[model samples]
Target: MPDVRYVTQGTRAAIRRTTREDGAEFVRLARESAAFHRPWLTLPTTERAYLHYIGQLEREDREGFLVCVRETGDIAGFININNIVRGAFQCGSIGYGAFPPAAGQGYMSEGLGLVLRHAFGPLGLHRVEVNIQPGNKVSIGLVKRHGFRLEGFSPDFLYIEGAWRDHERWAMTSDMLDQRTGAG
Candidate 1:
């Protein structure tokens, strides 16, 4: 049975805020998906580490959501909107990961679309940005499909896996999303 507490629902997937209860399952998925996530991500795969990871998400500036398969209620991925800035700049940075059995099944795509809606609607965010490693073509394609514009390139933008990495900055504003969906 699908969880009735979905924050947003799509055709094949639903997203809900990630909680402490998700740690064990998330760790299992992460550990199992290690090969799929290497170089691009370094998620917690142990229970203790997972709890610590979850703790950081319990902040005013962060929103963590799990993308669940609507049919089986299996966790397909996770999306997080971080560094929320209110006041003059209503923006957030989005990061996500798609796990095994759901990586290439379009579930994450559908889930991401729902997340964008939630971000613009209830979250009241005007702009959202994704900074991805330059070599990560799959991630780049995902943002492109979602109508995020290629902003610029940032060299040594983020430190990952003990080294500075180059990143391509992609961004989408509420207006851009509106225009894409012909809702503007």
Candidate 2:
């Protein structure tokens, strides 16, 4: 059994750390949602790859969380904070994917709010950045809904699928979140 650790909770969903036991279900979801992902993102769809994915997250610079529906405890999506930098930076890049069943349901929005709170609170992060392919409107909208501001654009920023893809950078700071919530 996976040692499920709840990272944070929201009204309709909860964020929890990914676990080794999640491999099977995670891979199944990734495989089933392949069409939904396609050129946008690539996820671990095999057991071996899943294990490697988990191992990568175990590194100090990365953290992965599963967004699960509160009512049913079913995974709605996944979010990862990658390339964490402390000291003067105190920042990390974010990557996320919503499963087919959970897409367009607003669950990811609620779950992302929980993640922001975790990032600013326990994680002590100052800023979080997300890079999205320009053609992926859904992903851009998701970040916009969460108060991420457009930073800039990068040509051939990240290699996805088979070739290099252009991306738009979006970011949010802890101070910005506090301001939005009237806490700062």
Q: TM-score for all predictions?
A: 0.97, 0.96
Clashing pairs in 1: none
Runs of candidate 2 with Cα error greater than 4 angstroms are 1-4
lDDT of 1 by residue, 145-170 (tens): 99999999999998877789899999
Q: Residue 62's C-alpha lDDT in candidate 1?
A: 90
lDDT of 2 at 171: 100
> How many Å off is the CA of 144 in candidate 1?
0.2
The stretch of ten residues in a row with the least summed lDDT in candidate 1 is: 157-166
RMSD of 2: 2.0
| Candidate 2 per-residue C-alpha lDDT over 1-184 given as tens digits, one digit per residue, 9 for 90 to 100 | 2224677777788889988999999999999999899899999999999999999999999989999887778899999999999999999999999997888888788888888888998999999999999999999999998899999999999988999999999999999999888886
Query: lDDT (0-100) at residue 145 of candidate 2?
Result: 84
Error of 2 at 72 (Å): 1.1
Error of 1 at 1 (Å): 2.7
By lDDT, who's the top model here?
A: 1
Error of 1 at 170 (Å): 0.4
